[model samples]
Target: MPVSKPLRKALQHTADECIDCGKCMTYCRFLAESGSPLSIALTALSADENVDALSHRTYDCSACGLCSAVCPVNAEPDNIFTELRYHAQANGIFKLDQYAPLLNYERLGQRFPFKGESLPEGCTTVFFPGCTLPAMFPDATRIAFKILKRNNPKTGLVLNCCSKPSKMLGLKSKYEESLSALVHTLERKGIKKILTACPNCHVTFKQFNTRLEIVSIYEELKKSSFLPVTPSVKEVTVHDPCVTRSEDSIHKAVRELLKAMGVRVLEMKHNKSNTLCCGEGGGTNMHNNAYARNWSRKRINEAQRTGVPMATYCAGCVNFLGSDYPTAHILDLLLVKRKSIPKPVAFPFNYLNRLIFRFTAL
Candidate 1:
């Protein structure tokens, strides 16, 4: 159900173009440590290989687009990973049990119904909060709603799955079905502009089509001063999302926002354009939680060196990190909370990095 001529063509093109320069493997925290080109290439060629824990490997991708960024032939390992994900899903091998919290996501979308609370009144902008944020981090969604109301005033949220989780885990039919539902919801609402908090969903939407103005919340924040800056957060480290920052300038806005909040920010050695994956993207956690945990731990330790709280704009990153250290989402940090939980973002980027490197390097 997932394969098509265009999809096949794109996949093979990327596969054929690979120079096997090993440059991608160099920075590939995945291949650099546990992976091999032969295995990765096989996984890409066809999803038939046992791949033994291939699901875990797929989920661990972080979908950071880094491989594509470093490729000499522009083979785009990220794209290969994306296609393989769909194949994995089609084979019923890549289900996200870790995202159980978001199981209510689809129900919530249908129950809440983006019918009444949507924008343009017959125009095109829709507020799409991916499954993770609304279900796991309600506060961010609350803040998102508050800001959307304050800024656009007329715009309303379009509740739906965005198909990111489904797509990432390789569920082709489900992904398309979810995407169709989204398109129908928007069309029914007469909405055009799509504003999303999750970067992965934003990218999925763009991949399907670019007819609408897909804007990120961080991007919207840059245009207007809706939320007040927090002077208390004098020092903090920012974590970038692998799937989100491929070619976007939003991470810069995040740094700017942090500066505005009075947070003296320190950059990660792999920050911005070369940002590291939280190890949870690319559906890796669903494939291999332990490996995902190790990758996340590595990142957490990196932030710990700054001797400051770790901050990220992504809810998934926030949830993954919040399990261990004093990790907080930028939205939660920015929002003045009456009662707060000072938990840190937990998951490590890699076990090796966590064990081998110390914070002094940061």
Candidate 2:
């Protein structure tokens, strides 16, 4: 199959630019194994690379945007890798049976299997609790939503997936279809803005659904008064989700909320736009569990240095990082006052929790 325009452009750009400085590989194992984007692009364009191997390497990328983050020439190798994954999938060159579980989970999200919405009259904005949060911690989701509604009566609830799984899996058609439905639903409901509880959803809406304004729920929380809590914890390290790497304002909101609770914030070595992945990025774990945990362990190693609990804004991040250390979501911290992380919810329970929230919260 002929290379798609986007993929070809990304390839040509990297080939023309990247000077093999190796800066992007400093923190990425995938880049270390696969070589610089310039090398990959040159070999690929010359037909000197094996297609399957290259495709596998591309899919192994965390899609964490770290490569482009450090690139002095800004070649955006992740973009090239992303487009190549799409091309491979579209052309039937990509297939991994291990992805069956992930595909099914994404299908459930796209199907509105357990969706709920509360769009009352005069409600122009929605509080999207997102998939993982509501699934794993329905109570926390309820608390977060109640806070949202309390802070702004005009606020509403939207329990829908952002179809990010499809997008990350390189299912271009499915991603567009599911995302279009979300866009249409927001437009039909007259939702002018979204307050996302999950950073991934925030990124999704901001990237794909420009028709509606996107705001972080943390930002919203920062704007309101919270139930006053005597501080049992004095310090924490904030794990800024890699998905929200560019959203410095959201990061500030999280820290401000922590400060309000009288907790001192510890900065990680890699933070803000340069924050490390929680290892769940790019659906790479579906391909290589060890590789995914490698990223997670790196973050754990960083958090361990501070000798403090790690607080993150995303429930998904908490779930991924909790096993190695004491990690809790910002909402879990503010609403529930949790000191220890809960066990990661399994499949049926996670789905059941979402279903229960459908009846109870929405």
Positional deviation of 108 in candidate 1, in angstroms?
5.0
Per-model lDDT: 0.64, 0.83
- Tell me the tens digit of each residue's lDDT in model 2 across 1-362: 66777777888899998999999888999888889888898877776234445765677888899888788988888888888788778777778577887777666765565776888898999988788898878887888888888878888888878888888878888888888888887888788998898898999889884779888888888888777455446899999989888898998989999999888999999988899999999888888778799999999999999999888988788878887788877787777755465667877898898888888876
Model 1 spans with C-alpha error above 4 angstroms: 1-11, 32-62, 91-124, 136-140, 227-229, 337-341, 344-362
What is the C-alpha lDDT profile of model 1 across 1-362, one tens digit per residue?
33445445555676578766788777666767645444465554575353334543555666667778767787766765666566555556655677664444444444433212445455466577665555445555666667777777767666556667666656668777768866766766667788878877777887778467778877777677675644445678888877665645778777777777677888767666677778777656755677677677778878888888777878778777777766667766676453444554232322222222212111
The backbone clash count of each candidate, in order, is 39, 0
Write down the RMSD of candidate 1 (Cα, Å). Answer: 8.5
Q: Estimate each model's TM-score.
A: 0.78, 0.95
Candidate 1 residue 73 C-alpha distance from true site, Å: 3.0
Error of 2 at 30 (Å): 0.7
